[model samples]
Target: MGIGARALRQRVRTAESEDWDFSEGRIFGSMCTQPAPAAVAAARRFVTSNLGNPGLAPGTARLEEEVVAVLLDLFHGPAFGAGGWVLSGGTEANITALWMARNASRKREVVLPESAHFSFVKAIDLLGLEPRWVPLDDQGRASLEDARKAIGPRTAAVVAIAGSTELGAVDPIPALAELARAHGVPLHVDAAFGGFVLPWAGPAAASVPFDLAVPGVTSLAVDPHKMGMAPVPAGVLLVRHREMARSIAVASPYLSSPQTTGLLGTRASSAVAATYAALMGLGHRGYASNVRRVLDLTAQLLAGGRALGLRPAVEPTMNIVAFLHRNPVAVQTWMLERGWDVSSVSAPSSLRFVVMPHATRGTVAALLRDLGSALRRFPP
Candidate 1:
């Protein structure tokens, strides 16, 4: 309104316009690709079969309850005072968790590692709570000592990341739990990646527990959309204690579904049905194997990186791999020209990769080749 209206309106119209192929984005980000190893036929069948009937009735509600129960068992909340809600995606799940932790504890400050998903910061901002920043170790794992320094009476809760977004670092949950216990604060785990992989990681560790099964983990946010390989907009927040989730449970009888917890609105049972089908589709062994494959790829590529003289940021134990190049901008451009999409990451100056389900040995080999060539040609 302040400037030339005609030019501004035309410029705005142009900016909003583009022929973006929706499926192209999913081509690389096929988190749901594992659900249907052959194709999405099986996953699609599950969605169509359940949602084709239409309308959110009592049957749909049961389906929602079933998915929640399965996730609760998966995340070690079943035995404790476990409860959860089916969510649209990682953001909603995180938002719900932050809100719950704030309201339940009635405190002004929450502690989280610097490497946590950005949503935690966003959630804190939106919810108007102070986040006490915890630094990470050399390996990117959040430091318990740093978190301990940040906590006191005003510390409402401690949020630990099971699988960090940039580097896939798993903070020491048991240590953080001890800190939370000393202060009588609830501990929340954001396992957006590790939730699906923890069960697999635990067995190979040849010993102890994985997640909330650890005594101190009171709640977790598991994104079905990320590791569960469900369709987009699928995530679940599991609280070890149902009373903890009580903060988000609205009691409006006039709306009809008084028992439900989460953002008050029409629930999408379709995503839940897809998630249930995906979990059942893989079973435990298949998922474990898949996790190992990505980990193996991570190792292989990290080795390749070392061979090529690219300094890796952390020794990866999960799908994400990050490293600093001598000249990152040029390296990224050269790599993109050759094909393959890599992302720039903060916290450490580096390129980050999600070794998704599609990345095979051959694929990794090709990527490594490009990486080596880029390093050789890198500007000093």
Candidate 2:
């Protein structure tokens, strides 16, 4: 009531100006994406709806169910009725799965690779579970041999990355699944980066078994916000059986249903609607096209980096391409000064680039040109 609309609009414009333009396609820090217009429109349409309390918005609940169904099918899982829920992002989805796994296995030990996302550290800290860190293989995938030795009677679950955040290396999931089956433990695949891209990544992607169809993978976390071009705060945690959600579900007497299985209360219905719209609007073919383009850009990025004398840390399995440099910090600084938003990978002392929908071919070529100039100055 106090501030005029004109002033408020000015404030919003000022704030937006401070942030980097995503459409410029220069950011390479995190999995930042330009939300698809269809998804954004859907979010705007459902902005007032609430998904936190299902009883209050049964229609939104149905839409959420549909989103889950689409994701499940994409991940090659069982039918929609099996189990899953849309959450905020990979972190929440990961914690929810860990909570269920801890309860289901009746154990407090979780084993994952060092390459696992920092979200697992939060899970271990929040849940009071002991974490056993396994080493990564030469390719940056979780070591299958070490995983076999890690699982024991107190082991709650083993986590395998579908497409790791740093180098985008897909793990030996089928082998890890076999280990889980042998140990009678749950295996959760963190497909936050790959889930939207891999299924449509052509026949070559079939070499990596990182889907629910694999024998012993019991659950997974996939982010619609990452590669699905959905608005932010849209992630889905899926499990093999519906009963899995039952174990750690809490009873919310105030809500329509007596039990609530999700990790968060008062979720944004807009995100759910947007994710649903993205799946429906793009479909499989649309996503396949997007992945193909991203992969192509990634190839260009790799080639450009190599031509500039930087070596790739790993063979890119997905849309992420990282190259090790003699002085990554200097390169990052140089790129930033030139209006590029790039990040450094600490593990291999490299520069990371995520080729997503926003990274157009022309923009990638421009980036390569700039990168060449930066290398000439920095010499690394």
Candidate 3:
């Protein structure tokens, strides 16, 4: 006899209960938050739809288009000629961007920062492209001088990180864009985390230019799942021109669309629905409020760490905070033992924390109390 739905659900819930709950606010090392209620509902409603064969799910496809359009406007892309797709998250989006660049330029070298995500490593390996790494400055931003030296005739694309994973550093994108323009190569900004945060970050982030609006920037990737209060598997890839994506297209003879542009074949429409619902429900003001709350929480974390004799690695540029530590890995292990899930960064040898929306004042206080005890034990 088949198992009943109630029993199956109970078994699943038992398994899931073992995992850390974001609402408890112990997860400080991740970029993702507990998705918005509306987003969750929309995702559930569209769980069976698939955009891979758009003819069968035309409404879902249209929803995906609308999501792309909204993101393009948010990122300040060109009003008319820009195009995008909702793919499987930053890795696929990054790979797709490089694939397009490699096909368009027929070049093997990609200039990028040391702070760039590990996804780029996979991208270059899979695409048969070479990475010309540029060192970062004291502040974790990419060194523009080294980047200039790295670019050459063999360069396919210049990769910049708008929100670095380790230190939350924003690279000198405007300068890099100009350099790429001088070298006649395309610029791809990995704003997977910042794309949703920076726009609403107010005047502090206004001076930074890390999108398609800047000249020489051909493509950009952003994740709605990170800071947009959307569920997982929702990444947006925007290109300055519609034709730029054509380089990576392959014929899908049996599908509703003659060609597919991304790495995935049968993507879930749940992500599309969830992303659209998140964007539409929150809008600018709602997201701005979310950003404000997280940023404030980040500030609190930094101040608390300082009071505990922990030094910040750098003044935080976003909701991410890191503190200099003699043994970050040991600290991470200690925190894990205590039921708090934090991370460590290698480059600066520090403990890392991302103050997502799920994190609250009470949680920050609880984390600080544990951190002080950990510091007394670790002596750094």
| Highest TM-score model number | 3
**Clash count, candidate 2:** 0
* Model 2 quality (TM-score): 0.97
On lDDT, who's better, 2 or 3?
3
Tell how far residue 340 is off in model 1, in angstroms: 1.2
lDDT of 2: 0.87
Give the true-structure RMSD of model 2: 1.4
The root-mean-square deviation over C-alpha atoms between each candidate and the true structure, in angstroms, is 6.0, 1.4, 1.2
Give candidate 2 misplaced runs (Cα > 4 Å): none
lDDT of each: 0.73, 0.87, 0.92
| lDDT (tens digit, per residue) of candidate 1 on 1-380 | 47698899988888766432222321222233434442244344445333322343556556667777888777667665677776777778788888888888788898989987878878999889998998999999888888979999998788888878888788888888877888888888888777887677645432435467777778788887777877666788887878876676666565554544676465556676667777777878778888888778778888888788777788776777888754566777777676556766655878777777667877788888877777788832
TM-scores, one per candidate: 0.85, 0.97, 0.98
> Where in model 1 is the C-alpha error above 4 Å?
1-55, 78-80, 202-210
Best by lDDT: 3
Q: Name the better of 1 and 2 by TM-score.
A: 2
Q: For model 2, state the Cα shift of residue 327 in Å.
A: 2.1
Clashes of 3: 0
